[model samples]
Target chain A: MNTYDLIIVGAGPGGSVAAKIAAEKGLKTVFFERGRKPGEKNSSGCGLGPRMFRDFPEMMKKLTPEKCHSMRAGVAARNYFVNKDDIVAGYIMARPTESVSYEPAKSWITMNVYRSEFDPWIAEFATDAGAELKTSTLIIDLLKENGKVSGVIDDKGEKYKAPIVIGADGAVSTVAQKSGLRSKWSQNQVTLTLQYDFQAPSEKIDDIMGDETLAVWWGSNFPASYQVFFNDGFHQGLGNWMTWWDKTPLFYLNRVVNLKYYQRLLKILDAKPRELQAHLLPWLDYPYNTYTDGIILIGDAGGFPCPLEAEGIYPAMVTGKIAAEVAAEAVSSGDFSKESLKKFDEGWKKTSIGEEFEAGAELWNIWKALPFSPKETMSWFVPMIMEILGGIFDWSQPHGKRVRQIISHVKSYMPKATPFIMKNVFPLVAKIFEDDLDKIMDPKKIMKVLPKLLDMLPQKKKRRGSQEK
Target chain B: MKIELEGLTKRIPGTGEFISINSLKCNNCDRCLFVCVMNLWRKKEGKIYLAEDYQSKCLECAACFQVCDAGAIMFKYPAGGTGIVIEKG
Candidate 1:
């Protein structure tokens, strides 16, 4: 049996961060990943926030020029069609500031990265800090001794022992399950999202997207939830909710609806789709306890993926760092019990995760209730929310001012005509401030309850297929 | 050749789940090939191909299939005793 002070499963942002922090603190940390390399199995339209640079300054210092790609500004555009053939588009632009510098084309600077390049770059920081990384290895089970998690068992029946185990294995977390930290997630608690990365010629991309701004297209035709993101040059990623697939018999029908919408977009840009890739993203909605005796879950394993934006990289890294802090404290104390690890859970909820989810859940519910047309939602609701937030709160302000502004904005939006926002929104937002305000001050509560309210809203029936095996 | 698209929809090689591809809707953009961490997509001449060459390397993250825009890349859990077999280090 191999032993270590801490063992982290999965080498995505979460696992790697945890390993780096633990190793830097002089703990014997060993990280395991099933992928051939750190970022090999990971993919995302990631927005690496500035706060990450503040938290992990050392890791940032290690970033080589090849590893970082910069974006200048962020634009949210909507394509509205008068008919199946004729479409009009509009956009909203925002400049990045000191606090929110990661938006595309911001003067403060933000970078877009290929996970394949980014994950290993960060993992190297951990290895340099003396953490052992085991790649191409699958962790099959949790070694439970006397009803407590002792370590992990790999497929080869080799048991690696550790005082603590951190599950950062992503949304479909094997470590979380094997360690008995969480039950199988409910569909409602998860959002199945699919995205596409289209490769185009650089000049074509520059002509279509222009220079260095991230462009987002919302409310095209698929649903109120559709978004297409343009990154770097020639790379565009589009995503839509998968729940809609249940309503129609033909899976491709959903794609057709999206494609038709994009066809109009293609005309606008005079560009064609070049390599299209799709993926299902598990967005966490409901809160699940993410810690157990000798075990803790971080990143997607803890359901920390931002439910609204589907952004996980920053939060994953943040949570991983927090988890490592807790693990270090536990290891120094020579104890790895649920009670010892409770600080991680408590600390996480106190941070941005709780508030972000609350806001995301509320936003999801309101969006779900809006008519299925993406055009209407994007044209009216999405911008309305952003404008409202921009008006009430300034992202460049201090944390206190931001919180106050968020509260004021929520109060204002609560009475709006959108029943989903009015009914499900305020209560969820209130929850974020009501109980956890001292520990965490996030405006995300308003976003959490929207889905449940949407479920209550009368909607169309779904067609069943020969049930998926 | 009589081709039942429905038959192709059943069973995702290793896992006991049915994965299907709407071949008619497939645009062959090859996005899944780029996103697949295992390099499961191969290019034959001008067309895109899906192979299991590095299938054993798949962590089942589903990033490739999730990023397929045309619904062309379908996944069926591999049959019993077949698919990416992972080993411990």
Candidate 2:
């Protein structure tokens, strides 16, 4: 019988952040993790943006040379045909400054850390902030009283009571289900992903991936997915997403995109494929109510992953912080009702985190509609944008000039280039580039719907029939 | 090598050292067959059969193990040291 002000389940990024924030706010917080350690069961590409660290400056302060790993930089995109004949729109030899340099082009700044190291660091931050952390404990069920969650019940039948229960559990969340917050997710809402980590010599990695660029291959003869090359110290990690096998048969799909295909791509790049490990990931899209009476679901459990990029770490952290903020306020007021916890959603909406998911969903739908031809997607946009940004205008300039140039380019090109642009460029720009650009330029109105754009597609049906049942 | 079983054992499909083929639950999806790194399983008689060629090549990376939702594929650590032995990449 252990009681606390807040009990956070699943010590992933979301759980740790909630625990840390709650403990820092002087609330009695207990965090439970099923893994042997914080990140043991976690796997991700480590493509986290700098803003994640900017928000949680304490995590960065705790990062040590041994704990942190860095990639100098790498190429961003590669385009190869399904026939394996020609790499028409390849970008393996691009410079770091070409894409994301203005933000901070630290050669060794972008790191590829094993979640084994990274997750524990965040968990330790929670413990250091005075939150009690229990590992090797699986939270099997929720303890409810009068239709309100009061605590958690673990596998060993041990019960711990808390005024607020935060479910930071990953995609397959038991807490969310037991709380009657959301139903089983449909296959369409989940993206089945597979990633591989390989061990290769540093020289080999540098030779193949180039000294300064993470390579992202698209529209290759391979699956409609993205592949990343990370040079983290001694290991060169490669991760890719696979199409949903439940929708398509794996053997037919695998024959099309297997080790042979990967080997051929590596050979083209003059890189050798090594010891590989792959795992599946489930990503959510539809919004499920995340808060209820005395309980809040954060992170993947809340379906908070960015649908387009499939990035979850930053959003998980942001949502975790918001949940903790609401939990703290509720605890202080001696009220753990659903009305008080509604602030979690309100606070999350106020931040860019909520906008990221909403925009990401829209972007995902647009991407799904577009053709998966890498040559068609990149040839028109990449070179055109590169010429405009690199050849025409200098990136190192006042923000206003850059904005004016882009606006003028769009305005000038609209009349003559509308058809071609709409056919090819609109999908990529609208889906990936627009929201991110809007976030940077005007945070106030980050979501910008292209007029008459959505109407172009048939109206999507409501969640009916099998989707809901 | 074919061996006959008695009673309940006859009712159950023989389990291999590395693979546990639950012929009943398998939907012939071939997810296990395709996702296998070692190319172990194949379709025959509308069911997946573990290939002898895969005995030496199984890396034990467990990609097949994780992807198979049908519980048709299972891997136990090969007796001591008989699977994929990696030197480098």
Candidate 3:
């Protein structure tokens, strides 16, 4: 038996981060990777969310330009919601807003990174912290001692012993299965997405998708997809709920790439197919069975991917650190009971994971449980929004028409967006886009429509207004 | 403008064996067919089966295993260093 104080399966963000923290705490740690290198078998093109820098404040200063090239591309949160026919329905350009805490988080929505380069870069920290990394090994299952997890067994049937094991083997986690956490995620809990990596000159990517910005496409016909521009390449990824797909993702990808929107982008970049791959993500909400005796699941294995955007790296790293601290305490105390490991659960609650995942779950469910399917919501929302914006912005439309467009669609959006509307958020958005409408706010026209808008309000408010009249 | 899926979906040998359907458990709901990103699950003569070149075509994300209600599909990541290498995800 190969014995270590801690055993970690998968060299992903979660596992590697755990290894680093555990080793730094003076516990002997060994992490396994299925790839020949740290991240070759792993996926690439990830957005290390703002929380990463917030948590590891020293990480920014630690990265020497020579150490990591992928990260030097800088940070951006320029998001685009693309509609059917590849039209951009909405665009959000990120800049500093009100902030006293975590200043980098203001402009840095996410730092785009290629896992092939980024994973190895992070994993090196674990090794430098005195953790051992075994590459090209798969921990097929968890080893048990009297119904308690003792460690993991690799594919060749070699058993490694430890008092604690962190299951970071991703969404399709083997440790999760053998430990009886789950056989696999159900259709509702996980989404499978396919990505096409198109390699291009660095200049080409910067010229097109903007070196810093990443775009996501959502539509009735196309489903959910993204184009993320990195240093040497960009990834066009397509995805949907696992159970709702009536056809393969490839079926829709073929149709989408044919549209003029993508054609012009591809032709300009002169991109070539570098790799086609897919990833499974735990999406809907968080998982209940994330921790047990002598075992803790982190990352997608623990169902920690973000509900809104499906980003896993941040939650994974956060949980990984918390789990490692709990693991170290357990090993030192010789108490590997589930109660002792509850710290992993309690610790993440104090961090941004709970706030992010909880709010994100509500926002995500609004899309999933909408009056329309995810596909229909995209089609319904985008065109309506685009028409209203076009009505207001385009000079071709008469002022009356723009006002009519705004009033007509006002009924569609107000109910859906109001409850969670941040203070001034809606008004700012309305103000920014309604400049043309502000000019055309004819009082007589407002008075005519105002009565109808007041009627749409509750009868009690209308009665109060009628008394004033 | 037109992207070809044929040349894009690539794979190394041996990982296709990672996912197999258990005969007795299979109810043939064909759910796997709908969920597969690569469309590697095919129906031939009243049976749902892994396509012949599944090893080459399968991206190995295991959407099939997730959606299968009958617990018929068995999936594992292939032995270390022998499966699909995701360049960017």
Candidate 4:
């Protein structure tokens, strides 16, 4: 039997960072990796958020060479919203100087890295800082004694004891399963993601990525959006609500991959599609049970990925550090009960994880409201907007014809858009976007919205039904 | 047009069976079939059955078990250390 102060499972960012901090605090920590080496399980997401450097300055030293280069001189970026035809309907170009952060040092906002390289580097970094690292060891179960977790049992039946255990495992976490924390995540709580990695030479990669750190293509005509990020190569993928699977996720990926617009983008890059990767990400819309007596869960295991972007690294590492800090305090006080571990939850809530999760949920609520199937809002709305404006301003059409076109189209589209706008869009705007609706509300705005509101009102027949009843 | 691609290559390395559907408990609503991205579950003669020999394709996301409200789906990790190993993660 081997014992330590804390045993962390999974060598991804969360577990490795926890191991490092606990060891740095002289807690005699040990972390286990199921893979042969850290980062061997190559789950690729675009980058580290600015909060990563803010929360753990030490990670500044661990940035991959590519990340460092991107950070030193931020990459140009473009986001595109395309229709089914793959014609770009919306686009935004971003420079590093346009980053959202007020802190100049954090201005890069996010630096992309390949998880295969980054995860391994961080795990070795933790080992270098005194955390014992065990690789290729699959933890079979959490060892329990007196109704509390005391340690873990490996697949080989090897037992290692510790006062605290952190389930930093990815989405399919064994620790969460064996500890009676969760059996499975519901479809709404997780997103199924599938991506194709295109391996391109450095010069080619740079040329393809020129003036763009990330490019996104999406439209209501498609089942979901697609994103491509450039690092050592191009990683393009789609993630959609698990519940939305009319067909397998790969079916949608196939559609996107074969789309003319996507093919053109690849042609421009002249990149070779190397591998197809898939992973499940937990998108916790609300705070979840993350800690129990003598145990804590972080990262995807805790369902800590961002709801908005599905970005996991920053939140995982943030929660990992918080878990370690709380565990250290518990160890110093000689208390490792659920009461003490609850501090891990409270500590993390105080950090950006809580706020980011809230934001993700807010945005997701509106996003999920988009017509799931048999409706194409973007395809219809964009052209209609242009037509309406053209009718009013384009001047090519006669005034009477333009008025008729605008009125007829508005009348037809209003009914369909009304339900979504009133049901999903309005509540979102009222609750999340508008803090002072009274002040924001003007006579003109009300007049503008009134026709749609009137159109949404119950029809005469429906009102007659109500009267009859 | 179809885009040809390879499925997951690695295994979870387990002798223990991971997913089982209790036919007796299932209503054969086929919800599991629709939810499983791996196409592992199917309905035949109004009864749900898993595909023969496609268990290796399971991502183990448990979407089937989660969507099965009838408690017919039993999902556990393949015996510790045996199941899908994401070699490339």
Candidate 5:
């Protein structure tokens, strides 16, 4: 029989989690994966963070680094902005702070894993919970009865029927489009990254990349280039929104590793390219719509990634659990109408899903604006920022003389900084946070910022620039 | 920018033919050439084309579909379990 009480498409974290819960609730559940296995289609090889641990403690505990074939990164990250001369202009090392209340903070931040290994481990939860998993099955269309999604049709000639279907299929969600609940992601809505996974011995990686497992390099020529250190290897790539792909992401990513600034890290990785992969990532806010009739969308299909970091797995799993709850509610009541299924939307909003999606709305918009927006003055401002910041510790004279020298040095960065402040930072701050623009621009506020602005000018600048007007 | 795909592994399934180009809609800007990770899209006599052996090499990331603004490219996942087998990522 191809019928289940609930059917979930795409057995990534979302579908698997939903299937697990649906089965536990005594619903005959089945989940399908289009790839040969669950993780084969998933990409990015991203780090799974503390949110997963906190949310699903029991589920996470079983999938240790050894069990899941994952690399644990003890270090958080150190960020850098590199200049034209292949030198660091500025750096901020984010040391993990000691936590007083948050328990997860006492532990590491992220566990880097190969998606090929990670996704299957999570799928085990569903199977263990008695949820049937069908691999190598692609849902090409939805089965509708009286204009409501009743089931799904796989790429094979088989059909699966259920009262409810959860679309956990990712960014190019065929389920979402076929159900008429959503459309294709526009260029601005999505971005893709191109990466080459470089291999090395596990011990070699442990020594070469210690506390700085994540080393980010931001230059004008490339979209934020970064290296993600794994147990035996690392993934290096850069990406920008589709709207910004004038040269294609492949072009920009290839240029990133070859740059003089990245040569140092490249030498240490000293490994050959093992796998070259590109994956589409969703950068959307909490979507306006998620459920309709017998259909509910979760994960990337629902566009549930956090805007700040595009973290999808947590949202996918969280939304999947919520969707399954709603599915159980619908199955028991024998009501799968659009109105009844509306609870899926209400359920997610009341949880961290709402907070994450709503919070990152602004940051994601700013990121999208980076490449295509005409106001991008980063071309000039970054070089200037590098010179000022990169020279911050230089001291050839007495402490007093060095202090005075730094002041004069900051003067050159102002003209270029002015436009960037006005164009990008200032407006984003005013528009996103404060209700009243005038209050944010009040002279008191301006005074706090203007002293530095005034320092970028001539004569007695150091002393006069410090005092309030 | 040198692209080395010599180490790439893909399991072809039944002569995969999921991506197609609509030549009538082709503006010939040729963004497809560089965007392809596998470099499967080739240009012959100034017309962009794909080789018959593309199934063996294509990773099916559809970077070309994402970049083609002129509506000339049609892309779909090959038959289930029929495309790139990502072992590392």
Candidate 6:
């Protein structure tokens, strides 16, 4: 048995980060990668969020000009909403930096990185920190001692012993499966993604994508949303909910790539895919199991992928650090039990990673659980919501009539209009807008609109009479 | 139309066949068909099966194993360097 203070499976961001931290703490750590190289089997074109710089500044020093593309500070959040025919339905561009009410100092800056270059770099950081990395070593299962995880066994039937093991083995983690810590993710919990890496000239990518801004497209025709990030070239991909498919992702990909909108962009970049990559990543609705006795799961294996954007690099690194912090304490105390590792669970939740996942889950459920299928949700609900919000500030309509129009629209679309109106929507709206309502109710604001409101009263009464009849 | 992934080859030979579905436990919910990006799974004669020896096209994301509620899917990654590899990744 090869023994170490800690053993980590999978040399992706999670395992590498854990190894770096543990080794920094003077704990002997060994991390294993199944691929011939650290990132040989990993996904590419990840967006490392602002939290990456905040949490791991040392890792930032490791980023290279070739491996990473530092997104600009002024890059705004831009969303292009496409309809069934690939027509742009609505566009939203918000410059967080320009918002007076928003604090620019706390804004997030995203970095685009290819895992092939990024993973090997991070793994090298761990090695430089005195951690041992065994490449091309496939960890098949966890080694158990009296029903508690003691270490992991690689493909050659060789067992490596450690007081603790961290499973960072991406989505299909063998350690999580074999230890029975978690065997499989439900369809709803994970998503299937397929991405194409296009090799374009740096000048072309900059010209087409505005140098630093990232762009996202949401449409009914797309299996899921599509994203484009700039690396040396362009990384464009689509991911759909695992169980929401009417056709295979490939079918959707073919359709999306040929769309007029995509075709125009492709033309600009002279789109020729250098490679195609596919992956399964968790989109945890809420926090799921991540830690166990003598073993902790991090990154995709632990279901820490950010829910809203399905971005995994930040959560993986953040949780990796948190796990290492907890593991270092556990090793120092000579306690490798579940109770000792529970601190990772509590500690991670309090961090930005936990907050992002929790908030992302709420946003996902609101979009997913709407009383419509995925297609309808995008085609009908999203555009309608955007239009309604757009109408709120439409100066052409009287404010009073606009309010009535918004109420009518809500009632028309809701599945059970009466109960939804009476039980939830009305009370929540009233509570939220109570102060604004008092201002609007002022005789001054209403005086100008009284004639317009009174003129509409007969029509409203006639409509009510028909309903009652 | 199937998009030709030129220069695409198995990372290692004969590894894609490791994942399979057990017929006894599968209730033919067609979840596998929905989840597989390669279109490798299909329902035939009221039974579900892989449409072809198509695992080489698999991304090996384990969506099939995870999505199958019937516990009918048996998933194991192909031997190291034997399945798909994203060279640019």
- The candidates' interface RMSDs, in order, read 11.1, 11.4, 1.8, 3.3, 2.2, 2.1
For model 4, residues A1-469, the per-residue Cα lDDT tens digits are 8989999988899998898889889998999876677765646554667677777776665565753332222355565555546565555577666446555344453566666667877787689889999887878789888877899988778999998899998887888888778876777887777777676666776665663666555554554554545444666677666667777766666666777767876777776766566667787786577887888999999998876666788888988899999989988998998888889888888888887654556566765655233144666654455445545664566655566556666666665666656555555555565454455454457657878565554233323345553
Candidate 3 error regions (>4 Å): A72-101, A367-374, A397-401, A409-451, A454-469, B6-16
Instruction: Kindly list the per-residue Cα lDDT of model 6 for residues A1-469, writing each as its tens digit.
Output: 6899999988998889999999999999999987778877987436666667666776784577755452333255567777767776676765446443332224534566667677888888899999999987778778888887788887778899998988899888887888677778776777788877777776776676663456666666775554546555556677766877777777777776776777787788776767777788777866567777888889889988776666788788888889998989988998988888899899889998777654554545544543214465666655566666666787777666676676566544544433333443433344445444344354445445644554454344333346653
All models, DockQ values?
A: 0.07, 0.08, 0.71, 0.32, 0.57, 0.58
lDDT by residue (tens digit), candidate 1, B1-89: 11122221111244333244465676776555555433556677756765643343444545445556565755432332333322100
Ranking by lDDT: 5, 3, 6, 4, 2, 1
Model 2, range A290-358, lDDT digits (tens) per residue? 888988988888877776665677788999999999999998898998888899888887776767655
How would you class the docking of model 5? medium
Tell me the tens digit of each residue's lDDT in model 3 across A68-121.
Answer: 555534445454556655666665555445663575666656677778777888
Model 2 DockQ vs. reference: 0.08
lDDT (Cα atoms) of all candidates against the true structure? 0.59, 0.59, 0.74, 0.70, 0.76, 0.72
**Could you say which candidate leads in TM-score?**
5
What tens-digit string does per-residue lDDT give for candidate 1 at A272-353?
A: 4332223345565645778878888888888777766557777888889899999999989988878888998788777777
Worst-scoring 10-residue span by lDDT in model 4 chain A:
A66-75
Residue lDDT tens for model 3, B4-32: 66766445565536889886798988888
Tens-digit lDDT track for model 5 on A184-233?
77766776777888887777777776656776666666777767788788
Error of 4 at A213 (Å): 2.9
Q: What is the lDDT of residue A192 in candidate 3?
A: 70
lDDT of 5 at A173: 83
TM-score of chain A of 3: 0.84
TM-scores for every predicted model? 0.65, 0.65, 0.86, 0.83, 0.89, 0.83
Better of 4 and 5 by lDDT: 5
